[model samples]
Target: MRATLIEVAPRDGFQPIGPFIPTDDKVSFVEAAHAAGLRRIEIGSFVNPAAVPQLRDTAEVLRRTAHLEGLDAQVLVPNARGVALALEAGAQHLAYVVSASEAHNRSNVRRDVATSIRDYGEIVAGLPAGLRLRLNLATSFDCPFDGRMEEDLVLSRLDALLAHREDVEVGLCDTTGRADPDHVFSLAAKCLARFGARTRWVFHGHDTYGLGLANVAAAWRAGITGFDAAFGGLGGCPFAPGATGNVATEDVAWMFRRMGVETGVDLDALLRLATRAAALPGASPGGRVRAALADRCAAA
Candidate 1:
């Protein structure tokens, strides 16, 4: 089966860079990705401007592109207030993050896992009709504060998220890049067994330990076809100390292209985007394929 890829460079990948992505360029990036065959993308986050200055113009950006066709523009909302902001901007798809480890959850969202889940439920309940919700269980594999996390804790959290709303899609986060193939297989098998066909699973993995691709392979074998990837491998977990960047969009696309699995993304275009993005004030992309792409571009 073909994998469904969500390009998150404009949001998850770009927000972590030193300087904020210019509003115009942010829109351009979104447009470029769409033109390159990425139908789904996380456009921005709706959080406190002080917390994530890069996403401060999320509303403005969304307002301008609200009429774009053939794109599922997603926004990340950290709380009910953020959800309200996203809804105000007409975001059709919303993503909420909750860490599986209690320490990470408290540090990241200032709430325990249970409270965060409850808050997400409240957020979803109040959204307008036709809006979709996706909950990303961050730190599902391990935590910086508490070290390795057990599969049971992650499963329990998934159960809570699924129980809250049957329509909610879930992404298992390998925050801190602590996941291996075995870990992915075990957690995914449990998720598939528990949620069965009711749940749609997406993998949100980090490349901290260089196991991102292996974990992706494991998830694919476990029946997951959707994944969250950052352009140029841009992004880091703010809550997890020493956590590395996310799985690179170009690297994963390159792998998929070579394997004959359709990701519906142009690897060459993605590398161009990554190379340019990496030139930004503090944007250092983590994709291994960027150097080669840069050389090719230079030669041309």
Candidate 2:
């Protein structure tokens, strides 16, 4: 009944903030999310610190999280160099992002679609068998600059990636938050049918146009359970201009619990994490439900 949740607050949620977040605050955020029972978390990205000032403390974050039990600490690696850095830092799991849209992929990672796929295949090939590698396929649903993404393109890319390496896990990303229920169901159905039980699909929804919740429902019905939700909805796509934050962790967890789906997440403790998020400089906590929950906690 309980579905696995990947808390992306540390990597996806914190990276897009306009101001610099203190490294200690980042540690507090991850620790609080762990207290809320988030077993899997993408803690940091091994990108250039000059490019992403927010994640300049990637090594430091990894070091602090090394001793935490019952936690799957992950880092995002864009290429082999990043992968090497992640492995050096003792990350048990690594996530690599590849975009379905060719233009977005180039803009985000400075590589064309084919080259990016090749790059990812190399990363997957070289990774130790026991370590987990998650491929986050961004712009799976739609792209701001490039209109709607073709399902065929997404599947083609998946086919190549899976064919190259069988052990990789795939994550479908609503990069611009432009996805709807129908889109989510169709794409997810395609993925589930093709992959069967061999691969796990993780849904990454953005609440940009208010379709995030509906998309989650569609994904759930399509048998896609694993998801990426940020605490207090404090995350956005750096590449997609004007994209909003992710679905709030508390909101999604509340929905699943009401529908008799167990998330194994403590809403009260999660709300406290959101409060801590709000205290971080430049973090707005865009989720309405999270704000309401925080208010209730304050009143109590």
Candidate 3:
């Protein structure tokens, strides 16, 4: 199966930083990812500017990249209001996140799980035809506030989301980076068994515990082909305590390529981009491949 890695560096990677990344720099990051052969990217989020000042110019970022051919620009929308703004900005793909843990959901979006589900339903219902939507089940593995979430609870939340819109893609998120290989494989197998042909499944993992690649491999073995990653491994959940950077895009691409999987990404170019990303203010590079590349350079 062809593996697809969705770049989230422009959005998730930059969201937790204190200083706002320049709008042009954000655009350049997207362009660099595209140049590295990534087709899909989450450029920014459409939420209250006061809440995440870093992504305040999401619309402008979208406008600047509107002419990029064959590139799918995705944006995170917190609710119906974000959905409206995303549509106004001519976004074709929108992602909504809701944690499985009630406490985490409330903390992340200031709404309870049920309310977030209802809001997602409203947003899904109002979406125009042909617009792609993805639901990120945050804390599917474990929650910082509530501890490890049960598989049944995650499935139940997924059922609620499917009930709202059966076609919306689902991404299992390890919000606090607490997922292990066995747990990831087990839950992914169950999810695939439940929703295999009905909807697409993507895995979103963090490397805080240093198991991001292992978890990704586990998910792949469980039949997941789509993944969400950030360049230089830069990202953390502002609301979810102890959460850290996401699985790095170059790291994932390198793994898949070495495994004889088709990722359609240029590893050398992606490593170069990772180097550039690491130089960004407050950026932290978290992928092993980058260090390996640095060593190779030093040896050369």
Candidate 4:
């Protein structure tokens, strides 16, 4: 079987890191990951620099690496202003994030879910043609403030968002990393059944409780092919309390490889990049395969 692994280490992984990664280094990481066979990569986000100081140079990074052939080069946008900044920087693919849990949404964006969805509708109205779109539904499975999210609530939120645009890729985020495989499978199944043919789907998971890969497998079984994983497992939600890094890209690739799935990612090259990510100043890296396979990859 075939699957897609969207590398988010640069955008999602680097956001919460305390030290500012040099612009040239960021560009190099994107380029290296592309060379390692990752066609789609979230370069960075178009948000307030004060909020996420590490990615302040996202536009520069995007511009520096935009020449990579066939690279999706995704940038995340939170509102209309972010959409403007991204488009101004010539971003072709934009991932817009909105929380499904109302309380978490308020805490993260200082607005209610209704207001965010309304903003998305307006964003869609003014968006230029030929620009690719993705919606990251944060806290779709669990929230630090509200606990486990209701499946119906998630579905309803999807219904509302898809109303504005159906030609989008939707990512269900386990923002708190408290989701079990059962919940992950059930909600993903529901989303696939309800909106499978309407829009593209992706699963963004975390390893806080060590269920990240298990949840990924569950989602994959439910027919979700695209997934978001950070190399070196370097990520967490600044707003979501107690959340940890994303499911490791190397770990996910390892699992799929053992199962005879094609990810188009070179694991040895990924291990090398992941080592660099782990060595970054102030980096709190997580993931199983990188540590276990280090000697093996080195000798190979």
Off by over 4 Å in 3: 295-300
TM-scores for every predicted model: 0.95, 0.96, 0.97, 0.98
- Please list the residue runs of candidate 4 whose C-alpha ends up more than 4 Å from where it truly belongs after superposition: 297-300
**Pairs that collide, model 2:** none
TM-score of 2: 0.96
Task: Give residue 145's lDDT in candidate 2 (0 to 100).
Answer: 86
Each prediction's Cα lDDT score?
A: 0.83, 0.85, 0.90, 0.92
lDDT of 4 by residue, 1-300 (tens): 999999999998999899889999999999888988999999999998878889999999999997899999999998888899999999999999999999999988888999999999999988898989999999999999889899999999999999999878999999988999999999999988898687989999999999999999999999999999998999998899888899999999999999899999999999888888888998888999988988854522
Instruction: Tell me the tens digit of each residue's lDDT in model 3 across 1-300.
Output: 589999998999999888778888888888888988999999999989888989999999999998888999999998888888999889999999899999998888999999999888887777788998899999999999989999999999988889877776899999999999999999999998987687889999999999999999999999999999998999999888888999999899989988999999988888888888878887766888988877432211
Error of 1 at 105 (Å): 1.0
The number of the candidate with the highest TM-score is: 4
Better of 1 and 3 by lDDT: 3
Task: Tell me the deviation in Å of residue 254 in model 4.
Answer: 0.4
Clashing pairs in 4: none
Best by lDDT: 4
Q: Write the per-residue lDDT of candidate 2 for residues 1-300, one digit (tens) a residue.
A: 777778998988898887888888778778888888888888999997777888989889889977778888989888888898888888878899888998899888889989988888777778786998888999999987897999998999889878876556788999888999999999999999987787888999999988887898899998898989898887887878978888888788888888999988988888777766756777756666665555654412
